[model samples]
Target: MISQYLGIIHPLFPVPSSSVKTGFTTSISAGDKLPQIQILPLLDEVLGVHRVNNRTTHQLTVPPSADDDHAQAWEAFFPEGCINPGNKVAPMGGFGFFMKGPNDFATELGKATSTHVLFNYEVLFESEWEWRKGGKLPGIFGGAGDAAYTCTGGRQSDGKCFNLRLMWRENGKGELYAYLPLTSSNTEHLLSVPPRSIQHPDYGFSVGRGAFTFVPGRWTTIAERIKLNTIGYEDGEIEVFIDGKSVILATGLILRDSTAIESRVRGLHFQTFFGGHAPEWASPKTQRAWFTNVSGAILTDERGIHRDEL
Candidate 1:
């Protein structure tokens, strides 16, 4: 039952003064409240924040709700966004941040000792959102802290690190994008609409592609459960629920094959951007997306104790 909650109404960090032009304002001084859970004092200081281009590109601001339904939310603005197709040097729009092991909720989640995790979040694509080719969304990541980037960037997994993120295709089509050890036995369990590989051959494949579609101008709730597989076992599981509807249920996933500390759910991988390193993936114009209610918990057994404890 241990959990952590993040809401834009209570900003995670102070909004940079230079971001005023983007409609970002300092939010109220209400701290993130975690009931029945121990709060980590170094939570804010240890986060790995990486902003694309500059801090002004992303900010926490008031949401565009019709009424007073939501107080505020985090926003990422894409201004003629693209990842530079030719040389693949410049990357525009979006922001990324990671919470690694032994920091913030990661410590409470038992670092690599725990094997299962449940995460939930809400996202809202502004009415002006233009879904070009597609983009990355938030999810979980684990492995060696220095080698965390190994799970992405077309790098193949060597039974060590792994990443699980969401992807959105044209017309708001949604799917699960993951980077992990893929084998002949586990590949057969991947489930998608019509079943196709939607990624580069070097990278990972798409799961549950188009199983549920995202709609702009409204909030979409996503809940995910990740269970790590035993060493040398292909029994890992991934279940996704979109707006309370079970859209994906896949088993026999071989996320890792070693009994190392890095082969488990480490922490949140908050990454959102547009592009496939191609010109066609660019956004047509300036647009925005909002996110709120980012939370996660380590599932426990019937006696309210982590499975490892039992």
Candidate 2:
């Protein structure tokens, strides 16, 4: 099947592992090469998190380090087919803790510099996760944006942060999209890249849009490179690649006002759930997703954009 879609392979992507080892699958063999990227400041291997729904019976466990490359490799399960009875309107799939500021995401990629962050995502099984309820799609915020978790200091509203999200569209297609939130006073701007063609008076702007077919039960690498816009000028830029394919290349974006605080690459927001305050968005059944090679770094030059050495 992979060879059938050989044309889609990005010239720079490494040959994907024919088989992956997970909690549900066998372990990675010693012969398999581990992901090797140069991240400056690394976060905790055990990403300690605060649960949103303490009563929810979701499970998050780290696989055996000997069986995997990264000691912190994590797998999250969302039951066979369960819904949050307490909050039916918004079903909460377990989420990892949100990391903020330099203390947590303390990297040389300071608040004012342009940087690139990289990570890998794979679905453990075929999960029809998107229910298409409440007008919002069902997915998870695995990447970090410049938004705040609480309404204090740098964080203001839901649309105030810039992050990457893995979403399942209403059609059941997997999507890798960028979510950039900018707000001031009463006006709010929510933007998306790759699906960037969407335009509305209230939804702000969705610029350079593109799509990729996520091969279920396979590994997909995501790389995000962003250059903060110069206030008052549409000079901002964002580029995204899925398995090395350039899915979105957007520019002329006005990210923030001149007086607004500088938004830096904080860390992973790690939000996963069904939302929109509607029943349609609920998971039809319990589903599970796995993530690994979760790492990032600053782009010092052009070579900084490549993935793990093949």
Candidate 3:
């Protein structure tokens, strides 16, 4: 019934609760968990974000808390379905924040669903293994030429340095692919890591597979530049920027005829299977960096954002 499935729950991600209650069908719940995914640090608020037919919408905020393990709100669509298809996990379409299921929930999440993953992380070196939670295989596999930790040395680029990446799902066979431009910054060079296979030697912090590395601090504004129009099909653009400088940029990047920097960009999104810099392949330095304020929309079909929007 589709090109392929990525998740089990048709998640209405980052939505706030209509009422303060833990209901799978409701956004609110009496459980411990990180604030709803749509946590806007700057707004001092939370939001419930969902999608339908691929269009994204925003809802009220679920109050904030110092907890990340919020509870599961909905009943099982199928207890039998619990054995989530790893490669394509289900997205909880509509549910209030629920109660936490168990202590090792992300472990459980890895088991029940979301196995199809491409690993990338910051460390002294990259590995040639897959990510496993509890000695069990995940639904996802990995990529090639792991981006290891730079030699405490350093790197520099001309004009500007940027971080670039590509986010794509694999075919059932588990090969690599991309559907969008992940990053297109120009200043990433100043930060140490620049475009392409080369990397910076200094130790820094990064998140979401280490592509969005920044100063050891929280980001004031996190935004992406994009336009969803072009001559061919699936035309779009995305420039990941921190503060206001662009990290990843690709013009006419998404049309049918364009080719891109694959391995380097993929390096950004690839997580670590072999624990390197961060514990268990996480960047120990990343958390020390802060992500305080947050305000970015979920644009599904917009061509571009205003200057202020970025």
Candidate 4:
């Protein structure tokens, strides 16, 4: 068992199909076997093939092509310490995906589709990595839904979607934030519910703070259990786990406005870049970080879905 709370699914365990639906209202019992999905293995399989994109120039690639000028980019920035050598994956010893500021960015490890929708992974920051000052902070793992999920021509449609980002603030503080689009009249810039900022007269605002503090070499496990909200109701749920413990739970939220877009997890949205989006956010010097044992699973408990860390 990699983690006590989030246990690793037995490798031999059968994976479920994307179309399989779960009873959203049923309570998951101790022994109930919910449909599961594994994402870490895909990293191993696609090492030299798949590379995803963000809204930036930097993109993730494995072995460089002959015509690739960035062929030496991997060696120059991310070196051996960032990757594991053996077949077995570990938190510290497994296959590592190294990313640096300015020229390095990771969005998705696999294709973007309405399949196997849960996202899970572990992250470790290199000592030299720099934290950004402001703007949308750098993210570890997030997702972008299909066309129906996002706004088109600046108009809100009957579609639905949400994005989750593990981010850091200016003072070097780090936390996890969930971005839920509000059903507003201005579709172009639909309002977003602030993180933990929903007002409670007695409790004050709840800032969705992360469980563990950001340490340069220590590993942090992050998992997001997402279920699209029932249209027009605050039944949508987005739960996050850090290092085997449930840290932030944002429930009774709205994930969609209409039934046109089925609430299904789309892309894993593997991101590791420095800036919010611009060149000004680029690092002054080169930086690096190591990530390993990335995974995704669909468990009834949501909190128990594990991605092995060593």
Which candidate's TM-score is highest? 1
TM-score of each: 0.75, 0.60, 0.27, 0.52
Error of 3 at 197 (Å): 5.5
Error of 1 at 257 (Å): 1.0
- Candidate 1: the clashing residue pairs are none
Arrange candidates by lDDT, highest first: which order?
Answer: 1, 2, 4, 3
Q: Considering summed lDDT, which 10 consecutive residues are worst modelled in model 3?
A: 134-143
RMSD (Å) of each candidate, 1 decimal: 9.1, 8.7, 18.1, 13.0
- Residues 197-237, model 2: lDDT tens digits: 44334333334333654544545555444555555665555
Instruction: State which candidate, 1 or 2, has the greater TM-score.
Output: 1
* Clashes per candidate (backbone, < 3 Å): 0, 14, 82, 4
Off by over 4 Å in 3: 1-46, 49-194, 197-213, 218-220, 230-235, 255-280, 283-290, 297-310
Per-model C-alpha lDDT, please?
0.62, 0.40, 0.22, 0.37
What residue pairs are clashing in model 4? 90-94, 91-310, 107-270, 196-206
Sort the candidates on TM-score, descending order. 1, 2, 4, 3
Q: After superposition, how far is residue 236 of candidate 3 from its true place, in Å?
A: 2.1
